[model samples]
Target: MRQTIESRQAELNAARLRMLNKKQEAGDRRQEAGDRRREAGGRGRWTEIA
Candidate 1:
């Protein structure tokens, strides 16, 4: 019975780690998208001025 409980706990921990990794990846993608928007906006302003 105790072994079963330990195994279940280990599975839950592994699932939690996977979820955290996914969240980190999503955040990195969001940062990259923001960087791209900022770069595009800068170019747009330069074109408007010219």
Candidate 2:
């Protein structure tokens, strides 16, 4: 009975780790997209001035 409980707890912990990893990945993607937008905007301003 105790072993079963331990196994279940381990599974839950693994799932929680996976969820955290996914959240981190999503945040990194959002940051990358923002960087791309900023780069594009900077280029547009340069083109207009030239």
Candidate 3:
């Protein structure tokens, strides 16, 4: 029983790491896109109007 619980915990940790990596990758892509937009011009649909 203890071994089963430990294995389950390991699986959960591995899944959590995978999710975290995916989020990081998405964030990096977003940042890169934002940089490209800024380089092209200061015009983006999501730009806030102040």
Candidate 4:
């Protein structure tokens, strides 16, 4: 019984780790897009202001 519980806990931990990794990847992608917009002289920001 204890072994079953430990295995289930391990699986949950792995799932949580995967979710964190996916979130990190999404954040990195967003950061890269922001960097590109900045490199383009803030054209996107200007449009938002207008």
Q: What is the C-alpha RMSD of each candidate to the true structure, in Å?
A: 6.3, 6.6, 2.6, 3.1
Local distance difference test values of all predictions, in order: 0.82, 0.82, 0.85, 0.82
Compute the lDDT of residue 25 as modeled in candidate 1: 100
At residue 5, candidate 2 shows an lDDT of: 100
Q: Lowest summed-lDDT stretch of 10 residues in model 1? A: 41-50
| Per-residue lDDT over 1-50 for candidate 1, one digit per residue giving the tens place of the 0 to 100 score | 99999999999999999999999999999777767767787565443331
lDDT (C-alpha) at residue 18 in model 3: 100
Better of 2 and 4 by TM-score: 4
Q: What TM-score fits each model?
A: 0.73, 0.76, 0.81, 0.84
- Give the range where candidate 2 is weakest over 10 consecutive residues by summed lDDT: 41-50
Q: In candidate 2, what are the lDDT values of residues 1-50, reduced to their tens digit?
A: 99999999999999999999999999999777767767788565443331
**How large an RMSD does model 3 have?**
2.6
Error of 3 at 7 (Å): 0.4
Tens digits of per-residue lDDT for model 4, 1-50: 99999999999999999999999999999777777777778865432231
Best by TM-score: 4
User: In angstroms, how far off is 31's CA in candidate 4?
Assistant: 0.5
**Model 1 error, position 43 (Å):** 6.9
On the 0 to 100 scale, the lDDT of residue 26 in model 1 is 100
List candidate 3 stretches off by more than 4 Å.
44-50
Better of 2 and 4 by lDDT: 4
Q: Write the per-residue lDDT of candidate 3 for residues 1-50, one digit (tens) a residue.
A: 99999999999999999999999999999888777767777766846323
**Candidate 2 residue-pair clash tally:** 0
